[model samples]
Target: MNGVVQNDAWREEYNTLKEQYTELKRLKEEVKKLEKSCFTSSQKQLKKLSTIKKQLSKGTSGQEVTAKEVTEVEESLKKIRETLPQPNNLFLRSIVGSINVTIPNSEDKLVYKERYENFKRNVTIVICILSLLAIWIRGYTRLPEFILQFVSAWFYLALTVREQILIRNGSKISTWWVLHHYFSIAIAGIFLIWPEGECYRNFQMQFLYFTLTISGIMYLQFIYQKGQLYKLRTLGRAHQMDFVQDAGMRSRSMGDLYFLVPFLLYTYVFQLANSYRLYNMYYMQECQTLWQVPILGVLFFIVALGNTWTLALVLVRKYNS
Candidate 1:
């Protein structure tokens, strides 16, 4: 008798999920027609998107969902996701990412989201660890700054390729984030051409420390994000790729922002310190008899300001929401 009752309850929930899916599919069509007015009707479209998100996030009510329903939900959502404005660094994706020497675009094939994210995390760990090691043990190798430049460029290229893959695979990291890697690559190139001198000796060791700090932070973030993604995968809402991992909770970008506050705050402080040192160098040049402004340092200062502002926005949105 208990088994029969449980079966009946599952059947009822299954029926409801099917109805919700159908309604979401219908809204998807409406969204397509209104795509031209999407900017104008931003609020309405946001609400509609939220509704679709909720439908997808619905979990098993202690009942086994059929494979057929699962496929339908996945297909329906992916189709809509394809319609989202593709945010990416066009030049990097179009030109740089396809350079024959980089990793092949295996990501073009439909891969499991969690598996793909894990791959990205692995790549991050491998590249960052290698770069940090090269910096720390530069004595034995007697490596030149150009060696670090080459390594930095190589890693940033990998980053560019990875961001392209993520964008194609429905990750929500913005085009700005993708472009950041490009700037990093460009900076590494600048570092390659920068002549070694007394000024560089003053800057080199500090920069190496900065590199280690950033790399360490990235590794920690990877561990946290990977665990979070695993939880989302277990919960069956891993399909909501955009909001998972970053947020400890589902459908809460604000929660992700809050969760990252500590990390982002550290980032802000480091960037601020870096920018201050750069500004001091630049000011000294102004007061000196020679053209001594640190061009790369000034550029880093500018980037630091932008990053700090971006973090502030994330925090403000988190609290307001």
Candidate 2:
């Protein structure tokens, strides 16, 4: 009797293990089927998205659509997007109906969208505060120049955060932005070490250094942006995109001649200023304040004239268009 009872217990244990194996196999098959279905659905959605993009591109411009038509399209696309199996598909959804989707082709679209909207709201608040501070700095408060520098540094730091977001969202880095980033850091460093209660003469020298540094950095940035534009045009041609080279191909006129001449003058002046400063530093000699004064004056005049001409040209083009 004891032997028979032991046999029955062993048999029951084997049966329980067999049942668990069967259930495991069933679950594995179900998962595979679900995965296959998901892939099929995703492919279908992608095709639909491509179709919509093509249709929108064919239209005159997204803005040309009637308000009612836009509303209808948006609602229909929103419904289809809502039915998608995964939230990662939101990037496709955004392109279907929106005209100016800035955060394109990002994998984490939802997270990025939320962050971008919050950033815009914060910028608006900061701008208002800065406006108030500017008024205060000019009127009620007689803050030291260093204090003004500190405030400017902080304001630029806030702007940097926004730029970082743009970089993460795959926007091409502009030369201007790259220089601005480094220049902001350099200015912040200068302010941190700047002596307290310095004489007005000393302050003026420091301010001049700051101005020269900023001008040099910005000039480099302009050159970089121009180069990037050229490269982009070349790329567009290689890709056979319907790119209009109207603006790129137009030969700059005599009105614009003054613009290029000044940039060349400024570059020369910047190099001269750097050389003079280095010479004075190395020789332990007092540098004359007027050494680069003439060059600076010329730069100022050229910048003003170039800016006026550029503005007039832009206005005329816009009005004509």
Scored by CA lDDT, what does every candidate get?
0.59, 0.46
Best of the candidates, TM-score? 1
Which prediction has the highest lDDT against the true structure?
1
Model 2 clash pairs are: none
Range of the 10 consecutive residues with the lowest summed lDDT in candidate 2: 238-247
Instruction: Write model 1 residue lDDT over 1-321, tens digit each, in one string.
Output: 455454788899999999999999999889656753643455455565555555656753344545466567666655554544433456654765543222213354334445556665665566566667767776665364456567777777766675565556566665555656766777677766655555555566666766667766766766766567666667776655453335343324665545556875676577667657756665554323223235566556666677677667656665677
Pairs with steric clashes in candidate 1: none
User: How many residue pairs clash (N, CA or C atoms closer than 3 angstroms) in each of the candidate models, in the order given?
Assistant: 0, 0
Supply candidate 2's per-residue lDDT for 10: 87
Look at candidate 2 and tell me the lDDT of residue 187: 52
